[model samples]
Target: MSGIYIHVPFCKQACHYCDFHFSTSLQYVDEMTDAICTEIIMKKDRITDQVGSIYFGGGTPSILPQKSFEKIFNTLTTHFSVASDAEITIETNPDDLDAKKIAILRQLPVNRFSIGIQSFFNEDLIWMNRAHNAAEADSCIMRSQDAGFENLSIDLIYGYPLLTDEKWHSNIRKAIGLQVPHLSAYSLTVEPRTALAAAIKKGKQVPVNDEQSAAQFISLIEKSGMAGFDHYEISNFSLPGKHAVHNTNYWRGIPYLGIGPSAHGFNGNTRYLNIANNAKYMTQIAAGKLAETVEELDIYDRFNEYVMTSLRTMWGTDLSKIERDFGKEFLNDTIENSETFIRRNWLENKNGTLTLTQDGKLFADYIASELFLIDEQK
Candidate 1:
């Protein structure tokens, strides 16, 4: 399946822990939206398959007005053949989803909402500098449900200094109580140049505890399983058949066209990233020039990419696919590299499908890297 991703690079406030490209000012939102629409028109030829999913990812897609959404939707439908039941999603913040706004959205084609409700506690929101409060977090879900948007997912953060085990449990319980079909939880990482990183450097805030993060993750897995949710991806949990189509397509190496500034796209072998600055992106798009960088993948690059993405998924890596797509030599190398982990019970290889055990998922990144097709290893 193929998909489309549009990045909205405007936000009301900058979260201390976030490192994604976005601007706090709305001065350029209209221009940015226009540029995104133009980019879609300019690159429609690159999309060879029907778009089964279209995701509006952020900065904060919700910050845009309903007209912006309508304009972009018009452009998309005009340019590409969107599937009748395409999984169209918008990533939003809690503070942005008022009754009025929800009503506005109900008129649009947005069928899914990926809310950034990092926590349900005021302290946590304060620490992260999230614009929404505890009240808004709880209220937004109900508002969306009332507005008839039932296909919802929420984000939660763990391993932050303020989140206690008790609090983490409460967060999970809250999500379960809300009956959201999907949940995407992430561990807080201190990326360089971000407020969180700077605070840690100057001793203004505490650093993240890995051990604490691990325990919280395991707790999430256990709780979600008890609630009948699939631990589908390392960071995503969902009820059966509720997996995010756009993200699932991405993990499975399907082609997608990415629109807007800072968005990335992959069409089987070639990958591209659009210019990150809003003004520059608009200028280039207005001038009928492309503001992006592209790279063509080599065989080894493709193999390593598959290994990296597939290992994080519950479906596991396919050995036969490797042999068929990357040759038997690559398949043999994969099996050889996987031996130690399989012996350790972190990875299980059954009938040519290699998957990470529950225990191995904690070290998934390191394990996938070990199975990489490095030059010497290849």
Candidate 2:
């Protein structure tokens, strides 16, 4: 079984740090929904297996009207073999999840809610220009649980200028205290072309401190572990048996279909990236065409990608599988390259599986890059 991901490209407002393709204006939401459903049909043959997971990510999937969701779901059921026990999720915001909204969602197949509760602090939310207030962030969770949506996850951001070590600790504690099954926390990054980046360039905002991020990341790992949450992936934590199936499949290199403007789909050997422009995407779909570009992965690309993604998970990378699939030469080179990190206690090669040690996860990117089979090296 594979996964299906739909990217909703509309938002109520812009977060200062967000660089994902989205529009603040929502006048064309219905048209966008139509295009999304059309895209889903157009790519029907892409996945022949039953869809075990369906993720609605966004701009803000919560903002869509029930009719729009119904229309899309109708199209999906008509075309795809969605599993009986599919883990259908919708990425939502607290402000949009009113009792009325929750009731509407209950009527649909949405079983999981990934809420965007970046902070419980009003000041911090205002700084980020998020739509919801502190009160909404706190109440929405309780409300959803009371409404019987227990398969839940919430997002939190740390390492920003307004977040002190004390505040960072508080944020982690608050999420755990909420008793939700899963949590996704990320250190604030200054993406180029974002408002946060522009502010830093103009000296209007203080630059993000790498040391602060590292310290807070360490704190997050320690605190969450104490609460009995598994540090399953680089940025995700979950209680036992609560790992996100869709995202876990992604890390495992399972193929999934991506729908909507700016969405991406990956088969085992190639990637499909859709156009980011809203009007252009709609026009192309209306013309019975897909606004997508395809990239076929060469052997080196596939090997390097596997290293990058698998190294971030708790299961680690399997050297035996590498040799079986890519060849003995690749496996030999990998072992030779990993010797330095293994000696430093940053990597562990136990039972033919290479995993990042606690200290090693901090340098995950660097380590993976060093292990990559670049064309020059090939």
Per residue, candidate 2 scores C-alpha lDDT tens digits across 137-227 of 9999999999999999999998899999898888888888889889999989999999999999999999999999889998999999999
Q: How does candidate 1 fare on TM-score?
A: 0.99
Instruction: At residue 34, give the lDDT of candidate 2.
Output: 91
TM-score of each: 0.99, 0.99
Which residue pairs show backbone clashes in model 1? none
Total backbone collisions for each predicted model: 0, 0
Q: Write the per-residue lDDT of candidate 1 for residues 1-378, one digit (tens) a residue.
A: 589999999999999999998999999788888888889999989987788999999899999988899999999999889999999999999999999889998999899999999999999999899999999999999999988999999999999999999999999999999999999999999999898999999999988899999999999999999999999899999999999999998889999998889999999899999999888889999999988999999898999999999989999899999999999899999999999999999999978899999889999999999999866765
TM-score of 2: 0.99
RMSD of model 1, in Å? Answer: 1.1
- Angstrom error of the Cα, residue 160, model 1: value is 0.5
